[model samples]
Target: MAKKETVWRGLIAACGLFLILLTVSIGVFLCYKGLGTFTLYKHSVWEFLFSSNWNPADDFQGGGQVGAAIFIVGSVSICLLALLIATPFSLAAAIFMAVISPRVSNRLLQPAVEIFVGIPSVVYGWVGLTVLVPLIQKIFNLQYGYSVLAGGIVLAVMIFPTITSVSADSIRNIPLQYQEAAYGLGSTRWQVIRRVLVPAARPGILTGVILGLARAFGEALAVAMVIGKMKAFPTGILSPTNNLTAAIASDMGGAADGGEYNIALWTMALLLLVISFAFILIVRKISSKGVRER
Candidate 1:
């Protein structure tokens, strides 16, 4: 029995190590492939990262036209919009769940949230296209059903569950002794949550928001379905926009293998990765500060 248990533990450890190595290998491989495109184009990496016009047709030989500024702006705008919509709702819902009533939280609200999170982004996209687009078009009389506003709305729905779940967990983790101390000091429930609970959970909340942003950045199918996918810069929330993920999804198939167009798509992917890593780093810093203060 002892020998069998030891073998099982060894297998579990080996499997975990293998999974970590595999994940790192995949990241390195993608980074290398995406970075190779810039070198092939013969332009400085800075130019590729910052330029505004992305005319792959002008760079058949991989010479120029490597720009991502407009795409970056749209992505940032859409994510900001989603975050603006999701953060308050998620935080409030989390607070309600954590402090108000566990019966309501554990029975009804939590399951509802889990269900929302499980709903496919594609399904949300379809609903946005069919229901939201028509409503917006009727109200605003836009030329297109697909717009950045629609996309942002869809993204908000997708991100809500992520933010709420993480925020709830963070709030739940706050020490009960802290709550006792606050109550001992004659603090009201609202006062304790607004002051003590939220501050203590600030790092986790930020981390959740960052993770939600990352998720929104990588979402392609849903955004592609609602966003007009136009190459032009967005004029407003109602304007058609093409984010980095959408651009790649829209153009990848038509792009010739080893061609400038394909290379440009790869470059866009690398930019997305950089943005994601930056958010992760920021979250880690906030978490570190929270720990130091604690």
Candidate 2:
């Protein structure tokens, strides 16, 4: 039995090592493809990143360009818009379920939230296209089905569950005595929440916002459905736009045959990795301060 256990442990370790190696291999492959865009025929990295034009037919020798700032602006704007729409709603929902009405913790409300979380993003897109788009058009009198406003709204719905679940867990983890102390101080429910509970849970709340932003930034299918997938700089909240992820995902199939187009797609993926890493670093910095305070 001892020998069998040893063998099994070794097998598990080997599998883990293989998984780690596979992940590293993929990162290296992506890096290789990414560096291809830095070559002689390729546009300067700054020009590629800051330029708003994306004409694949234009060659370096032919004086053509592929600017990505427009896509970055669209993605960042969408993320901020989703954060604005989702933050208050998710935080309020989380606090209500966690502290205000603990009775609803495992009841119908909980299950409904789980159901919302389980619904696929594609379904959200379909609903947005079929329902929200028409509603917005009638209300705002828009000419088109695809617009940044519609995309932001759809992304808000997609990321709402993520924020709420994380925030609720954070609030729930706080000791009961925290609330008791507020009550002992003659604080009303709203006052306790506003002054004590919410402040104490700010770190978690910020994390939820970060998660929601990350989700909104990387969301492809839902946004692509309503964002009009245009490659140009967005003119307004009601105008069509495409995010970094959507641009790459939408164009990769045709570009996969190998050329500057393929290299550009990989470069976009690298940009996304850098952006996500930067956000995570910010999260870590916030977490460190919270640790110091504690």
Candidate 3:
């Protein structure tokens, strides 16, 4: 029995170590390849990051004019919009499931949400392309509906399930004693939920929001289909835009391997890695603060 326990413990430790090694390996590779862009192409790192122009054709003859500022802005703006649209709905659904109507949630809403999660991202893109695009265009009286707003709407729908599921689980896990104590103090259900449950579950809810943000930031195909791949800084939510992930997805295949164009894509990938790492660090800090408060 002791031997079996030892084996299981070793297996778990190995798995954890492997994951850490894999993440570190990926970060190292991105750093190496991304820095190669500046060295191999003689491109200014400042220009590559700050300039809005992204014409790779100039780099073919050693001009090195590639830039990603517009893409970065697009990525941030779309993700912010998606979060704004998704948060209220997700929190409301979570509250309903874990607080107001557990029976309904268990019987129907949770299953429906689970099924929504299984649906492919491409399907969401297609739906946006076929349905939401025309609707937006008609409503806004635009020549086309492919814009940052469309991308944000599609991303919101795609990430809604993740945020809702995680938040609901967090709320459900709050101790019954807290709820009973609130009630004993003559608090109503809404009061207890708003004051006690939400405050207690805030850390977990923030985790879910961060996960949703990560998903929104990394998504490519769905966003690409809806957001017209304009390489300029977006003027507004209704303006056409392109994100870093979409730029990589749409342009990488055509770029010459080991060429300046390919190297620029690697640089964009590095930026994505850095952004995701920052988000993880933020989560860690918030979690630690929550633990201290508890």
Candidate 4:
């Protein structure tokens, strides 16, 4: 039995080491390929970051202006907007599930949320393209429905289940003693929830919010279906724009290997990986704070 246990433990350790190596290899490869735009082709890093010219396919020599500021701005704006749109609704639903109606939530809402999560991204994109786009156009009386607003709405819906599920679990995990103490102190239901449960669950709630924002940021297909994919910064929420993921998805396939365009797209992917790392770090920081508070 001890021999069998040792063998199993060693196998588990090997699997863990393999995963770590695989992850590091992927990051290293991305960094190497992504740096080619500046290291090999001698493009100005500042120009690539701040300029909005983005004409990488203008010549066969793999030379063109490749400013990515517009895409960066688009990505930030749409993801933030989606977070803004989704957070309040998701939190409220979470509160309703964990605080007000756990039985009903378990029987109905949880299953519904899980079902929405299981739905395909492409289906969401297609629905946004067909239904939501036209609605936005009609509501705003615009020439076209494709805009940042449409993208935000689609991303909001896509991320809703994630935020709601996480938040509900967090709230549900809070100690019943907290609620009982609040009530013993003459606190009303709303007061107990607002002042006790929410404060205790802040870290988990924030983690959920960040995770939802990450999902929104990484979402490409749904946003691309609605967003106009214009190579310019949006003037307003209703304006058309393109983002890093959309641009990479739209251009990467046709871009020649070892070309400026291909390298630039890789750079955008590197930026995304960096963004994901930042979110993970934030989650860790928040979790540590929560632990210290406890």
Q: Which 10 consecutive positions of candidate 4 have the poorest summed lDDT?
A: 56-65
Q: Any runs in candidate 4 off by more than 4 Å, and if so which?
A: 57-62
- On the 0 to 100 scale, the lDDT of residue 254 in model 4 is 88
lDDT of 4 at 72: 94
Task: Measure candidate 3: CA RMSD.
Answer: 1.6
Over the full model, what C-alpha lDDT does candidate 4 score relative to the true structure? 0.91
Report the C-alpha lDDT of model 3 over 1-294, residue by residue, as the tens digit. Answer: 999999999999999999999999999999888876788778787888889878765244556578789999999999999999999999999999999999999999999999989999999999999999899999999999998899999999999999999899989988999999999999999999899999999988998899899989999999999999988888999999999999999888988877778888988999999889988888888778767877
Model 1 weakest 10-residue run by lDDT: 57-66
Error of 4 at 30 (Å): 0.5
Candidate with the greatest TM-score versus the true structure: 4
lDDT string, candidate 4, 50-96, tens digits: 99888775333666777999999999999999999999999999999
lDDT, residue 93, model 1: 92
Q: Which regions of candidate 2 fall more than 4 Å away from where they truly are?
A: 1-19, 58-63
Clash count list over all predictions: 0, 1, 0, 0
Tell me model 3's lDDT, rounded to 2 decimals: 0.91
CA lDDT, every model vs. true structure: 0.85, 0.81, 0.91, 0.91
TM-score of each: 0.93, 0.90, 0.95, 0.97
* Cα deviation of 92, candidate 1, in Å: 0.8
Can you write out model 2's per-residue Cα lDDT over 1-294, one digit (the tens) per residue?
Answer: 999999999999999999999968877887787766777346788877788877754233434566788888899888788788888889889988898887976696678889988998899999998998888778878887678888989988888888898888878877789889999989998998889778877787788788778778788888888888887677888888888889888888876445767777787887777777677887788777766765
